[model samples]
Target: MEVNLIVETLKFLVLGMSTVFMFLALMVVVLELQAKIIMKYFPPPKENSLVSNSTQELFQKGNFSVVAAIAASIRSYKKKSK
Candidate 1:
């Protein structure tokens, strides 16, 4: 009967969706646990003050070569498109 078919289809849809949802939930939990374990065993290195100061100094000294290159590329691309 059509009614029986509809009910069966609905049941199948619910089962499939539930299985997918449960799988994703389990994956998230496992990944979080793995990250915690790795962090505990081998933690990230602390940043040194000397390295931080040097990075700041580099920024303070305007580094314009990178900016110039990007602008040149954009200009070349615009010319090519036209």
Candidate 2:
């Protein structure tokens, strides 16, 4: 019957969605656990003040133009890929 078909279609859709949701949830938990393990084992290196670029001046106009070109190419590439 039509009613049975609709109910079956809904059941299939629910099952597919639930499977995807559970998979994504599991991936999140696994990735979080991996991050914690890695961080605990290998701590990040300390940044020395002498070699830091924190107080550097802003980029020049030519550098800004180059960066804009790179950004445009990256955007176009991403659009093509998608």
Candidate 3:
């Protein structure tokens, strides 16, 4: 009877540990799946234009050539000016 009780206790202990491990594994899988789904549907925000207002003001004026030159400039001075 003592041997039987020991065997039963060991069985229950193993069963409890396995149940805990399975629950933790399931939780990790669920969290990973949720992260992947959120990443797939929700893209990161993009950088908006900082010089749109200035560009619009230049476009409104008759400085089309200046705008073109500024756009084609290699030193990015136009970006800094805005």
Per-residue CA lDDT of model 3 for 1-82, tens digit only, reads 2579888899999999999999999999999999999889996665443344465677776668867876788358767788
> What RMSD, rounded to one decimal, does every model reach?
12.6, 17.0, 9.7
Give lDDT for model 1: 0.77
TM-score of 3: 0.47
Worst 10 residues of 2 by lDDT: 52-61
lDDT of each: 0.77, 0.74, 0.79
- TM agreement with the true structure for every prediction: 0.53, 0.53, 0.47
Steric overlap count per candidate: 0, 0, 0
Residue by residue across 1-82, what tens digits does model 1's lDDT show? 3579888899999999999999999999999999999899988776533443343455565646655665688899999999
The candidate with the higher lDDT, 1 or 2, is 1
Ranking by TM-score: 1, 2, 3
lDDT of 1 at 3: 70
The segments of candidate 3 whose C-alpha lies over 4 angstroms from its true place after superposition are 1-3, 44-82
9-71 per-residue lDDT for model 2 (tens digits) = 999999999999999999999999999998999977765434432222213323565566667
User: Candidates 2 and 3: which is better by lDDT?
Assistant: 3
